[model samples]
Structures are given as structure tokens and as C-alpha cells.
Target: MDRRTLWSNGAVAHISLQDEVTAERFTDGEVRRVTYPPLASLCKSPMGNRDREILWGQSFNVLETDKGWAFGYALRDGYAGYIEAQMLAPVEAQATHRITVRQTMALSVPDLKATKAEHVALSLGSEVCVTDTDDKWATVMGAPHTLYIPASHLTPLNDKEADPVAVAERLLGTPYVWGGNSAFGIDCSGLVQIACHACGIACPGDSDQQMAQLGETLDPGTPLQRGDLLFWKGHVGWVSDPDTLLHANAHSMSVVHEPLQAAIQRIAAQGDPVLRYARLTRL
Candidate 1:
């Protein structure tokens, strides 16, 4: 199968597709979950930057495994890559809380200073299930182990932010990563995904999928407002105001705000024209 023909292979995932595409390959895969907070799905077995990050609780459809690399699709967005075999859980786990802020560490205990070396860094939108709790900390089930994170650092999925644009503004200087979705690093679509999901909105993990999943298309001449989604061929961003556009882009190599018209002309000059504009619908 050509990489383009592989339905689940996202741009940042492994480039090749199986020569012989068959239904049996995908159908035979078993359900698994990402136990690691930021487990990477590398294009190669050992690991490299050409990899996609798999968030905790993201579903995996593992078709095959060898030499510690499990090959399959990330069911959340159908992006196929190779996640380390050890990064998966034996059974699917329920995720109850989402990390709200940019990035935080899940420590071995509640104390941040004393347990400085005993924490796992988790990015925004990473999920966890509260297993035990106290006033200052909550013991959550983390990848391959239990972790204690600040109780205030997490919120229920339904405890949404009021302004999606405000949520996107939280990461103004975050570095851009091709397939990244966390505040530590992000991409155009990743920024949109985090911002929308924080507001209790269900947005897909990629720009094209997001365009289809978002609300009714608006005419290009329609007045832009906060939360309006601006889409290009492989990019997406949100309107922070009538004139300001917020996005995690490669040109700046970080999330930034720029004039919407400037972005349109700059992108069009590169041949990736703005495909459409969408207004988010609360469902």
C-alpha cells in the first residue's frame, strides 16, 4: 500500500504503507491503550524525531509487533506509527481527568521539592484516572505505574473553559512540533485540538479531520470572531479576535498571533491556500 493509500497514516507517522492492503490486517488488531503520558510512535524501531506523540488513554489498534515496536493505528485520529511495545497497557483504562495547564509533573508523592526527580512530565490534554485523593494531591494511575499529581492541576472533562480562544492564548510561545499536541510543543492542528477540547468541544486531532468535524462552513467574507476556525490545506488556526489569528506555525517555529490577512497572503504565496473557515458549534 502506498503511504497515501494507507488511510490511517498521518503526515508525521511512518512514511511507507504495506504493499498488499487487506481488510484482515486492520480487523485482526486488538484494542490497547497508551499508558505513557507522551509515548512516541517512531517511524523506526529505535526512535527518531520523525515520530508522533501518543497521549495517555489514546486507543491503539495494534496489528503486529516485533523487536519491541508495536505497529498500528492511533484510534483517536487513525494516525498509524510505531509505539514501543512497553508503552501500552494490557487492558484499556478509563480516563477521568484532563490536565488543564501547559505542562506539569506527576510526582511519586505530592511534594514537588522533595520528589523533584520522581515525577513524570505530562502535557496539557493528557488523561488520567484518580485512584486515590487527599487535600493536596491525588494518586492517579499513570503509565505502567501509579503517580501522585496535584489535585488542583486536573479537572473533570465536563469542567470546560468558558472561552476556547482564551485557552489557545495560554500557549503563546510554545514551540511547534509537527505532530505534537501539548503545550511543551504543538502544531497548527494540535493547538486547535487542545483549545477546543478544553472548552468541552470535540475536535479531531488533524486539520482535515477538524474541518469536517467542526461546524458549518462560513463564507470567506463572513465576519471573523473569536473561536472561528481558519483552515488551509494542511493547517488550521483560530481567530482570537476580529483581526488577530493564533496558531502554532513553522515560520515562527512557535505559537504566535498575527493578522489574519497577513497569514492568508503568506500561506497563499506558499501555495497552501486557506481552504475554508468554520465556526465552532457547541454540541
Candidate 2:
């Protein structure tokens, strides 16, 4: 069981794992939705290293709560980690739309020009339940109140982008955060996951999981093309073309497009060579 997806904490575990894992306590967890956005970090330990992020309105299965932290897995990708308890709330409504823009504000009123309106920033991939809509704005349910956001920033939950690469291209310059998944910042695997999700593909949260579970491996000398996945020991990227690689890289501290051959050489020099080339069945 990968610890990142496993619901156990040595002493307790989700009831679903009872047949395979030992624990002192097993219980069915409660589901809750993230109330804060731009992004909320899910840390390996309470306030420790971030392992992933749960976007606003995304559901989390809460297995345990201690002090002010909730330990659970993100319902979207099953990545388990600790999140600040206050950042989540009881699910009041199912999500009806997904935020399509990089970022947008949920305002106190429908009018964008309202100077004193209270607002909260929402990020791309965040889900919202729109109760009402006009030509320019949507009224969505907030944690404790109703909020309005631009209608143009949202898409129906069932809609998907046709090309995953195009979804990633829109985030070309986002900062490379170690475990970030939002447009504000993202890692290599996070970028791939986000892009895949937009195209209605199921993806694992970590690079290793994605490499092992996402797609079929290609032959050693397979010709690269758009949307092909390239994996290194601890990193991953998308093939933008036969000659270009697109990824959120620590070396650059941002997502970028680089010559594929040059990237291969650069990464190899650091003792991590390209490990595999994969092509997804759906794309």
C-alpha cells in the first residue's frame, strides 16, 4: 500500500482497508469539501512538508482529526495527507461546475464593479455549485453564505477539454511548487494530473504512481509526439512535439518548454536519465 494513498496511520485505518491491513480501529470516514482556495496544502505531517493540494470544493475523506488537523485522502485522486481542519466544511451541495480560468474571485455581489464587496480567490480546477446564473455572473454557495463569480470562468462538471496538452500549455509559466496542483503553482506530476483531469482522464497524484499506472510503455526507440509522457527517476513531463518537452521543473523553478534532446542531456548529466516513454489509451 502506498502511504500516500493508504488511509492508515498505524493505529487507525479506513474500514475499506480492513481485509488487507491491520489497525487498532477501522471506521468509515466522513466526506467533507475544501472551503478555502487558490489552494490548500495537504502536508505529510501537521504543518509539515506538503505532499499535495486539495482544491476548493474538492472532497476529502476524513479518517481522523486531531487538534486542528484532519488526516484523509483527496476524493479526486486518493492522495492522503493532513489538511488544516478549518479549511474544510461539511458538504452542503454537489459541485455543478469547475473553474476554467487561472483564478477568479467569488464576490459578495453579482456586480464585478462593486468596490466594497467581500471576495475570495478561487483557482483553476476548483469546483463550485452554482445555484443561479445570469449572462455575466453565477451565484454559488460559499462556506457560510452565497457568493457570485463570473459565469465565463466556469464550465459544466461534465464538460472536458479536448486536448490535455493544450490545458497544460495555458499554464506554461506557473511557478514550480513541490506539491502544488493549482494555477498559482504546480509540480511536474501536478501539471500532468491537472491537464489529464481537464481532459476527463483519471490520473494518480505522484510521479511514480503516474508512471506505473497511467499508460502503456513504448518501445525503446519509439518516436515521440505530442502528449507522450516522459519519466525520469523523480520527475515527469509531456512531449510538446517530437523535439520539445514541457514540464514544471525544479531546475527552472517554473513550467517551461525546452528542446527534448537538450533536456535529456541536462537531466542525464545530473545522474537521472529518462526512464520511460508512455502513451495513454484515451489520448
Best by lDDT: 2
RMSD of 2: 1.2
What is candidate 2's lDDT per residue for 1-283, written digit by digit as tens? 6789889887779998999899888989899999975568899988899999989998999998999999888988888889999999998889999988878899988877889989988878899999999899999999778999999999998999988888898888999999889888999999999989988999999899999998889999989879999999989999999999999999999999999999999999999999899998898
Which tens-of-lDDT digit does each residue in 8-72 have in candidate 1?
Answer: 33222222333433333334466687776565554533364444566766667776776787777
Error in Å for residue 186 of model 1: 1.0
TM-score per candidate = 0.82, 0.97
Off by over 4 Å in 1: 1-28, 42-51, 115-117
Candidate 2 displacement at residue 118 in angstroms: 1.8
Q: lDDT (CA) for every model shown? A: 0.75, 0.91
